[model samples]
Target: MAYAIIETGGKQLKVEPGRFYDVELLHEEEDAAISIDQVLLVSDGSTVTVGRPLVEGAVVEATVMQHRRDKKIIVYKMQPKKKTRKKQGHRQELTRLMINSISVGGKALATA
Candidate 1:
């Protein structure tokens, strides 16, 4: 199988064509095309390329599928004998992306 390691939203992901991924929030409308260039590694079943920091001319193309919030998480705090308590809930915003293709040196290497 062909895949690539891409960095985005302060995290790295192992991505393949035709797959969907939920990542940190992105400031873009749904269906917008995005290209990620911070590719750390790429493998085509037989060959593998590893970047020092990032691979030159490597890009991963994706489309924004949706924007949504993750599951809610609750935080509670209490102070013993102080009658102090706090409660909070949070839901992180996230973006859904559909990976389209992976390319290097302007040549397409893999596609969905």
Candidate 2:
């Protein structure tokens, strides 16, 4: 098994091939290919490579599966003595990604 740790949208994720993740929304459309360059670490069965910031020539390839919003969250504000109250709901935009491959040292490995 192999895995890569990638940074995206101010978050770190451990990615494996054929797995899907929900991340911050990007400008691209659905099914578009996405390349992420912020690779922090990669590991194979016998060896591991950790980058100072990010490994050179390391990239993660993924596909944008869909665009959607997360479940709604409610916000309420009230003043006990002023008869003031407010309510709101919010849903954050998100993008669904399917990890295709992760490459290190110009070589690709199977991730599971």
Candidate 3:
């Protein structure tokens, strides 16, 4: 099995080709291709490459699937005896991406 660890949207994600992942909102149109260069590590079952902060010449290709928001979360605050209550809800914007390939040194390692 081959996999790569990529950093995006201030978070690290373990990604594999052919899989879909939901990440923080990105400023790109749906169906657009994106290249992620902040690869921390890559493994191909037998060999592994690690980076100091980020790997050189390593990239992950992905396609923007969609843009959406997460489910609402409710926040409630109450002050007993004071008769004070506050309620709020929140939904986080997100984007869906489909992993297309993993490459290193301009050589493709895996493709979906």
* Best prediction by lDDT: 3
Tens-digit lDDT track of model 1 for 11-104 = 9999999999999999999999999999999988899999998988999999999999999999999999999999999999999999999998
User: What tens-digit string does per-residue lDDT give for candidate 3 at 1-112?
Assistant: 8899999999999999999999999999999999999999998779999999888999999999999999999999999999999999999999999999999999998999
Off by over 4 Å in 3: none
Model 1 — which ten-residue stretch has the worst lDDT?
42-51
Error of 3 at 53 (Å): 0.8
TM-score of 2: 0.90
Model 1 segments more than 4 A misplaced = none
Mark the regions of model 2 whose C-alpha exceeds 4 Å error after superposition. Answer: none
Per-model lDDT = 0.96, 0.89, 0.96
lDDT digits (tens) for residues 8-105 of candidate 2: 98999998889999998888988899889999998876788899999888888899999999999999999999999999999999999999988886
Please give the lDDT score for candidate 1. Answer: 0.96
Query: Per-prediction RMSD in angstroms?
Result: 0.8, 1.5, 0.8
- Candidate 3 yields a Cα-based lDDT of 0.96
